[model samples]
Target chain A: MTPLVVGTSAIKRATTPELVFAVVRDALIAHAHDRTTVPPPLHLQFPDADGDCHVKAGWVTDTPGFAVKIATGFYRNPAAGLPTNHGLVCAVSARTGEINAILDDQGLLTAWRTAAAGALATHAMARPGAATLAVFGTGEQARLQVEWLARLRPIDTVLVHGRSKDKTRSLCEAFDALGHHARPALADEAAAADMIITTTPAPTPVLQARHVRAGAHVTGIGTDMPHKNELPPALFARAALIATDDHRQCLDHGDFGHAVRAGVTTDTSDTPVGLLLERPVERPDGAITVADLTGVGALDAALAAAVLRELAS
Target chain B: MTPLVVGTSAIKRATTPELVFAVVRDALIAHAHDRTTVPPPLHLQFPDADGDCHVKAGWVTDTPGFAVKIATGFYRNPAAGLPTNHGLVCAVSARTGEINAILDDQGLLTAWRTAAAGALATHAMARPGAATLAVFGTGEQARLQVEWLARLRPIDTVLVHGRSKDKTRSLCEAFDALGHHARPALADEAAAADMIITTTPAPTPVLQARHVRAGAHVTGIGTDMPHKNELPPALFARAALIATDDHRQCLDHGDFGHAVRAGVTTDTSDTPVGLLLERPVERPDGAITVADLTGVGALDAALAAAVLRELAS
Candidate 1:
């Protein structure tokens, strides 16, 4: 049998970001429901003059279509001015174990899957009239957040805040072309927005506790590694709900890790985003809601599997 | 940069079984001399239907230009007519993390490596002018053992024993074509040969203590799993020197496992094959010698790395 060869360009042309977002959302939900135990991924840390570590995470599910992999290369910082996070997603045939696709769009799948996590969280926790959206970080993920959030909520205005004003303004203009009232805003403007999405890799807190409004939903997908932080621990102290993709990973690397270390949140009962994504749960009325997404291997596998199915069909 | 792709046909055409056997022999010698803390390989078992299981063993080493994988799949006899043992060797590039070559030659690599282990043991343990050879099993590994033994030692006669007379005759013909005096013989004929090699996947002992010649050298490579046995425990009691690729693996799975269980051998201080292969060691003169080779992932990785280097040049 001929091996499947799907590239990033083909994946982009075949499916829209919105459709991929939706498929990824559903896949994450299905995986959340699956109770099968998977082996912990093998971790490989390379020994070099400069400390550059690569974590190879693998998950094989008995899904009928394919065996999907979400391999992310995290080079803390290379001397060559390359992005710290850059890698590819591979989908392989289950029967023959042939790699069918290489979606090397430089973390495009990562951004989409992360954005889907936010959408899934919104579907489970956010209020019905979440019209005002605030996104921190004017990079590719910031653009993806706007595209994916618009699919789940009827947003009339989006507040864009970044370290660079010119980049944020350009992002706002792109959002404006999508028929939304998007504008560069101060940090206070983010607090007033109904839903706040942070995608910056700031080493320090970018979102303050005092700026956030009551009943505001906050989704942080930036602080995936231990050293990165976008939200302060005090922010989750009064939040009604704090959810995360994987509680263990969050406690080790996400904003929840800082919160747990600071003695703000101790229990892990409702922290797992998978549990919240699968069912409609009651969010504390008029209380701040937070969802910390560190990303998971299963989510990547799911999205790759979904993309493969759509392309084959 | 374009990725390197070396398929089974390329490997078959570029390197002969004899050359591969010699390459492995030299690798074993090099590895024995290299001082490094080598750990036993990790095994992953998959539970299947009918109370059977599939095993996957992984070996990783930090040796330069050596990061290959040896994955074997074994299944119990079922209604399907698939071979009980089959798998592939994936040779990966250390610099780029790309799989450079795949050898799917019906486990030919395994047979060649095993034969090389036997040859290494013969060089270390056999006395001068030891010529007569006896092989148990008419499989691919049996053929490899005959050819490799002929290349290493001055062997003019070879006795072949197997359950199938037709297969034994055919294998004898192939060996005879290689300019050796070869013929089909009974299991008792092996007793007269100066050197013996066992390659069958028999669940019970195929070579008893009485069938081995005095002062002869024996190498068994088939009983790598706990449930498989090719040589009786009595043989272990008689051998003055017995070595293995990995002492821990042999104690857990190879012929040593059964011997230890039956109280035939109490100590394993001198069992690691590396000690014998690296330097001249003290052993009883004209005593029976044995080497158990369950295969090692580091060796596979090293051989794959060598092959990749050769291909690149």
Candidate 2:
């Protein structure tokens, strides 16, 4: 039989958040053991045209093939009421170089994989029995992060912080509909939560080091570009340990880039979250942990493989 | 209005050799002028599986678009009467980052583009009114070189030289059907022709430098890998000028690579074929010229845009 060429609808029906989260966790762990080949990501930037397209690819050795994802961000599309972000994924055979399937994921797979990464980070770093969670953005990622993290930990209250009050309230309303308690909170109050996730596209730091309390597990899921940052540079110094999905990628771009540039931390010795997952480390009591995820190719490859398997079954 | 998802049939129906040649030439020119951003090429090598997939992408400023080509080579498929090479092209809007078309060309576009590239080189470096061309291979590329170059130059006689007599005879029959004179000849006899084209995947020098006469314009198109070679190292010393689609790429992984390693040439300042095309050079009679093409991404980008335009019309 020919490889399936599926659309967004098929992918949505084929995968659930829990399955994707597990797949993503395994993929990231594979990165640490050197069981996967993830090439340095590349992109075509159309600065004059107000857009950029990032291309990432990777392959995992065990029961996993390969995948190539092309994700685009058109900063001006929202002005026309069109989608600002979208892309496709191609799953290929590691044995024959045959493209086994092309999932016109339309960026759905990317979103899910990203949220899953956040969940993995939160699970590995957050304090056990922590009841309060805070999200720094009110977008889809913020909502998904809250939902995914809730499943991974025992959470009772959710605090939301955004530049706009109405948008933040809407995010809270989403949690309320899902039978969870959520409310808009001030930036300082949100930073004080036991687990905080920053998913905003802010170009400057929104979370201050002074407000972040002890034993806080903070994950920065936004700031994919060099100019975009969410966490204050000083926060890295305040955290007990800084972890990242792909340390090299984060150091070159995203929040770590700013941190490095600001001389806040010249630490290239940060740990990969994969290593932390492979060998579970009980967090030193009352220690603050920071995770920076700028998205890597392995997670996409794993998610695509999982989705293809789902459709096959 | 929806982005066209086409296969080889549509690509064939929508493009003529001349149109594609023009498109490719324009693209190369755009590359020379630095009007196109051609990212470094990437590949996936499944050594255990005896397969490799090369991925290339670029964007031309004038077209305001981007293109990505995924070309795969599966070495063992020929035993099953299956084509060992296949790939696809995607043309996209740079302004909006929207995928405008998906050309499932099945490697047809790549073959045509390669042949067109040969034509462009021949037209640029071959002596005016050159005839009696010798092609050193019996594969599809060797055959297509004859057809595409015949239109670019005044060729009436073609000398075929391959180790396999049966394959060479069949190649001769192809030219015979086109109302041209083609006959099998010795390596020396072929080298003495006015123009020589080596499209064979020979791992060692096939054309001895002593056999290549003066005033012959030679092109080695088969040796894109470091381990492959078709032209003798000493041949470079005899040529008045060495031109390539991309000088940097050729030096890294083509005939130029072997020649450089052999100490036959330390010349890194070779002119680009586009420069020669832009300013048609009047070659002095009896001057030997060489052109190396290692497949650049700009040509793929331009070809995708051209195909999309044809479909739109």
Candidate 3:
């Protein structure tokens, strides 16, 4: 039989953020247990067009199949009145090379996976009894990260920080609709919160060491490309433990690369969140812990496996 | 709008091998003139499962758009009563990153492009008044190679050689139906033909220097993988000139790599077939010339453009 195509709507209906969290969480733990493997993503860049395509693939030994994602980002699409991102994921049997399904996700899965990774990291590293959460950015990832993090933690208020006050106010209003009290705040005000999520494309450091509260847990999901760095080098230096979604990737292209380059850290042996999930790290009550979620391929593969299983049933 | 779907039957009925040859020929000559560009193909292999997937993308500057082909080959598929090869070609707009159409050609386009390339090379490199042709291997390529070459040059007979006698005879009979006088022959007889084409996956050389007739033109299409070599290194030494589909690719993985490794010739600056098309090489009356047609991505892109053009019309 030909490979079935799972469209965006079907993908949305088949799995929730919580469900994705569970699958991704388990896959990470499995990877830490040496049960699955994902290689670094292959990037194709057309700098002249401000376009890029990331080809990611992974396999879980315990699952029925694997997935390869073709994700594109046209940074200049907003000027053309089109969506900034488009993606397709192909599921194939791990035992054989039979392709099972092609998911025309339009970057929805990518968004969900990013948000899900945020939630997973927060669940594993966030301080117990954390209440107020701050978000640094007003983009789609900023919104989804807040939504997913809210479901995983108890927070009745969110501190919004944005380069543009209008977008920040809009984000605050969106947060209010979701039954959370949110208000625009300066970088220092947002950084003082118990939990912080950085989700912007800032070329310079937005979250510095001085602004971070002592007992806070900060998640950085912004600095994906070489030019973007959301957190300052000193921020990583101050954290008692730094966890990256994929330690290997962060060492190469993620936020950790910046820190390594600045001479703040010489070691790439920062704990992988996968390993952290398998063996929880004991943090002191006043220690600042940072989680860098640069994203990984296993999340997509696991979610694709879940969707295909749901469709089959 | 959703991407249009063009299936195998549509691809087959919309164009002929001759049309594909024309489109591919013009594209190659244009590329030779530096009017088109194609990136190197990306290959994903599952060695344990004996499956491989090749991703090829290319575009013509003068054409409307570009194409990316996903071609798969599972060597052990016959054990499960499945075909060994499958493929899909995505036609995409060059201006935007939007995928325009997904052609489910099931490797039909791949086959056509390869055969079309053979015809193009033969047209450019064959000695004047060439007649009898010989094909080694009893596979789809063997049959299609004969068909495409018959259209490019004047030939009244074809000699077939294969490891299996029954399959070789079957190939000859199939050729007979195409109105060509074909008969099973040993390696020496087959090699003595006016032109010889090797279309097999033998790890060792199938066509050695001793077998080839002087002044005969040869085309090698089967040694695409790193481990496969169809023609012996000595055969290259006997040729007056050698041309490859892509000079960059041949130097790395094609038959040229083997010859270079065996110390036959250190110079890799062989002329590209595209250049041969644009400026026909003048070979003395008895000088032999060989062309390596290691199926290129441009051929697929050109044919896809033709198919889309036909569909639009």
Candidate 4:
């Protein structure tokens, strides 16, 4: 049988922020409960093209279908009038080994699911009624994180920090256009916000420990690869509570892992983001919290399945 | 751009045995010469459905495109009136990471590539003017091996060995229908043939060293996974020369690795099949030869690119 081919526009039309948040939330909880199977991703680097590709597959126990996704990034693509990312997800039947659908999302689902995960983690780990949000980097993810977070809670202020002043101004304008108070801020100034989210692909620390204030929650979203880091190890030493999406994956490639490798923290001090979603953790007065997210395949599978269900309906 | 979707019938019409042979031959040589990049496959197992899936990707240097392939096998599918294998190949542009086409061949490319590798290895390693061929296993691979090898050289007699008498008879008749003299024979009798090919997914060895003659060539195609072994270590001890498709992959999961683990042979003693294809090896008098094939992803990428090129033209 020919599998249903769902293109990017159709996928976008069929999915909503609420749908993605619910689906990704359930997936994270399922993963924490050990009810999902996600193999280590297959990564391929093309040095000549300044590009790389990642293939990730995951299956939730008792689900009707599984998903195999391919996401690629070519750093020079934007210079050629193309997006830096491209990919598709294949959803297959669990019983018959037949492909059920091909979600040619062009990495849209990846971005949305990642945003939902980050937003969920940030809301779950941060103190109640947190209003000010400081965002690092000025990419699509940075914007998505803010917009998705707005769907969950109220943010009174958004401080945008980026390497390029024009891009930073543009991102702040975008946030302002979305009916939020946004302005460009320096790294040290942004670090003093109520909640912080780092979304840069910088190789070195974008925010140091001393720059951050007490009672702030920082979520690291850009350090999925080994060489890319956004937070300094000294910051983890100050965080009273730390959370990770997946224990093994985050400990191996996440910002949390880098902190452990640097001897600032032990691996056992972190909690699963799923567990935090299930039961909110108690926060100590004047203590900081951090969440290290490397992204999980199970979340992608769940989100793809949810979108396919919506389309089929 | 919407990627072209090429289904099974179109893929078959656009490809020929000759085309596959040439494509796979060049890919093997490129892999041996370090001109190809093939990442280790991503494997997923679903115990509830008794199924597994393998995701492999590859790229040849200076090539126009690369391929990411998914092949699934559900052992229970045949009982439900479905084929045991299903899959598709995604061809992506190397320069921009844009998907060029999706060749939904339903695992046909994988089978054809495996057959081509086996046939090429057998023809190149077998003694000059060898006439008799014995095939172990009564699957599609066994039949394809015979047909593909016939394209490379002549076989005066065909000996078939199978556990099922009915399958064994049917296979022999199939070979006879193709105008090759064929009959059923025992393992010992079949091992004495000039060339032997084992295609069964047996946990234990199917042929022993004592059964094999002094001057014979054996190509193993079933031991791609760790638990599914076809050839015995004793057979490797009898083999004067050993050839592997990819040295690192073969040493990790191929039958050759099993033999090395059993203390039968060292890793360095084996030769790359591509090197042997470029410059045929000199055979010692009364010495046996064996080829261990775990299959290579580079071959899949090359074949998919070739078939896509054919379809486009």
Candidate 5:
């Protein structure tokens, strides 16, 4: 069968915040309930080009189609006036294995799915009435996490932290334009916020356990690669609860893996974020919660299937 | 940059047997010389649909672009008036990780490459002037094997062996149209031919060692998956020289693996087909040679790149 070639414009028109969040949430729950099949992702590194590509495929039992997504990141692309990321998702019929649609979303779907996952994990684990937020990156994810989470909870303040002063200031201004009281802050200052999300690709810890305030929730969006770490190992030891989008993936390359390898927490200590989303975990007074997300393919599949359905309608 | 979306017709227009053979040969040699980077392929099985999809990506050091190919086989599709296989290849700039072209060949390139590899292996390992050819399946590969091999060598007799009488007859007719003496043959009769190429996805051996004649060469092409075995394990034991494309992959999932697992051959007994292509292994009088091809990603990448270049020009 000839597949419908849906371009970025059509995909953007079909995508809604509600749709992304709902699909991502259901995908995570399905994964946690063991109803999804996600094979280990294929990662290709182009060190000479300062780029990497990830090929992820997933099948949810309830979805009509499976998605195989190719997402690439060229760290130096911005300097060449190109986007740092590019990708397309191929949706195939689960019954016939015939590709039905090529969603050339150009990495937008991945970004949206990631943001929704981070927001869901943060909202599910963070204490209620958490208003202040800290975002430790000046990239698309940092802005996305803060904005998407604001859809779930009230964010009265946003603390932006990054090594680049210019980019950090620009991100803070972007958040300010979104009507949140935003300003640049040091790592320690940002870590003290009520909700913290680390989105930097720092090879070393960006925040220490001692700097985070009590009753704070920290969601890690970076550290998807083995060489990346954004949270200190001691941070896991100080947490009241730890959660992960994918247990195996997060334990292999996520910050939780680093903490586990450092003996900060046992491998089995972290709970699946989907479980917490289904049945909210009790948050004690003055407790800290951490969520590690290394990304999951099931969310991509569900979101792609949902978007294709939306486009078809 | 906008990627060129070349459909099946365009792909077909650009593809030629000579181009396929040249690119595939270079890819094999590059792989043998460690001049290509091929990550482990991603395989997903959908038993409910009687389908499986394989995602393979590779980059040759000398190539300007890389390719990620998705090939799916739905064995039951033919009953629904659909082809049993479907696939596409995405070619990306290796220097930038930006997808530059999508060759929607719909599995044609894969079939051609497979056919080319089989013929190359058959010609490389078979005794000089070996003309009698026995193909153990009447599928596309079966026809292509006989035809492509005819391009490399003079085949005086073509033996088609398949379960379906009609298919076997049809294949023989096709070979007759191509001006070759073709007829149906049983296991023992076919195995006694100068060269044998097995193309059936049989879970058990299609031919036994005792049936194969001395000095005959066999190229097994269908035992790519772990559970599939096209050649008898004892067949490897009787062979004087064994060759394989991608030693690691062949040793893990190819017919070579079956032989090793069954204690018929040691793991180190098989030589890389690429090495044999570069320096032909001496064949003793009345000695048998066997080749196991599991399919390599580098060939896909190289072939895709060549096709894209052809389309552009």
Candidate 6:
């Protein structure tokens, strides 16, 4: 069997942002429904290293793509010229453990998986025909959120807030190319959108609690590590319902961790993304909803499985 | 840029048991001197499965060859006809994570690495010029043990013990063909040899305290998982000194776990194999010595690195 080399360039060539978003969304839903088998993340700590490495290898056998994936990332000091998060996802044959495809997109899989988590959360929490959206950050993850959210809802306008004017302009241009009504906005304009998506690596809080409007849904995806934060801890106090991709991981490394550390309520019975995806739950009509998408290995396994099946067929 | 495919048949064709022994032994010595970078083992556990699957991937950079190895195995229910242990070792590029070779020798890399571990322990613990040897099991590991032990010591005679007489006789024939005195013997006769190697997957104790003589060095490589045991727990009390590949793993899953659970000792400080390899520790002249060879990911990484360097040159 010839091994398929699905590098970052190949993914860029073969898949559009919209197609990737749709596949990833379906993959997340499939995984959350227990239609996939994703092994626990394997943790590795290099000798004398400041942080740890997380490895998740799994096979999504029932997802039409009998493929196995091995994803590895390093959570270490960024001063080492290595991104604090970088890894490759290898899709393999579930029948033979033969590596079939290698996706060299260092953090692309994480971005897509995070967006899938958002879409999954929105399906459970958002009101029908919810349109206006606000995204903080003009980076890869921010771009992914726009594409993925666009697929799930009919967003007539998008407010993009970024630290850099040039990046915000480029993001606006990209969104325009996608035929969305997008414009650069001040950070406070995030209150005008029905939904807010924050994807930044800032150590300090980028979104304040006062800027969030009532009944607005917020999805935070960047604070997946202990040293990073995207949303203020105060925001959790106002959230009527808080859902997360993986409660255990979120409790340890997500925005929820910061909230819990800051003396916020630790009641997590209803926060698991799996629970929201598996069962029909009531979403209060005018209450603030927040979904912490710290990214889960299961979603990556699910999407890789889907892509492998597609490529195989 | 071509991935090397070293299947079971190919490994059997490309390497003789003798050559594999030598390669593994040299790798162990080279690795002991801090000459390799060994990655931690990667694990995968299917949902609802009783046990986990492990993958050990590594690169031996300084050896004459350039190869990366991925060895896969499982600890699962034995009724599945799956051998409970199945794996392939893929040797890939040192510069790139490209596959160079795939060897499906039923975890031959395990056999080689285990033999190397035994060889390394013998080199560090056995009395200089030790000759007579006794090896348990007539399987591939047993064959490799004999070959590796012979390289460390000039063995004029080797006593073989196994459950089946016909299988032992077949092993004896293979050994005798190599011009050594190899013969099937009763388990008690194993005590007469200066060096004893046990490589069977026996659930209960195969070697007892009374059977091992003074100054004899024992290396047990079979009992790796927590449920497995090859050496009697009482034997650990009698040994003057004990060492292991990785002390924590050994304390958790190896013969040492059994010993510790049985209240053999309160302290395990002197048990790390790295201690024995790094320093010239004092061993009582006529005291019994024991070395537990539960495998470690570091050794796989070490060997893979060496093999890769060798292939490159």
lDDT of 6 by residue, A237-261 (tens): 8888888766666778788888888
lDDT for each residue of candidate 1 in A1-115, tens digit (9 for 90 to 100) = 2223455676676666667666666655554655322333333333442222222232334553232232334343445454555445545433333345555445666677777
lDDT of 5 by residue, B69-97 (tens): 98889999999999888878999888778
lDDT by residue for model 5 over A160-202, one digit each (tens)?
9999999999998899999999999998899999999999899
Model 5 iRMS (Å) reads: 1.2
Q: How much of the true A–B contact set does each candidate keep?
A: 0.00, 0.43, 0.09, 0.51, 0.63, 0.03
- What are the per-residue Cα lDDT tens digits for candidate 2 across A97-196? 6778778887889888898889888888888767889999888899999888877877789999998999998989999888778999999999999889
lDDT of 3 by residue, B19-109 (tens): 8888888877776666666666666566676877666777676465667776778888889888888767777655556767778887888
lDDT, residue B51, candidate 4: 93
Q: Is the docking of candidate 5 incorrect, acceptable, medium or high quality?
A: medium
TM-score of 5: 0.97
lDDT of each: 0.67, 0.83, 0.80, 0.91, 0.90, 0.66
Which structure is stronger by DockQ: 1 or 2? 2
The parts of candidate 3 lying over 4 Å away from their true place are A1-3, A30-49, A94-98, A129-133, A185-196, A201-218, A222-252, A258-268, A283-294, B29-40, B61-64, B186-194, B232-240, B259-268, B284-290
Model 2 spans > 4 angstroms off? A1-4, A62-64, A185-189, A257-268, B1-3, B161-165, B183-193, B200-211, B223-239, B257-268
For every candidate in turn, the CA RMSD to the true structure comes to 6.5, 3.0, 3.5, 1.5, 1.6, 5.3
Model 1 chain A: which ten-residue window has the lowest total lDDT? A49-58
Q: Chain A: TM-score in each candidate? A: 0.84, 0.94, 0.95, 0.98, 0.98, 0.79
Worst 10 residues of 4 chain B by lDDT: B1-10
lDDT of 6 by residue, B56-162 (tens): 54333343223223433333434555554554554433332234454444666677778767876876788776777888888788988888767666778889999
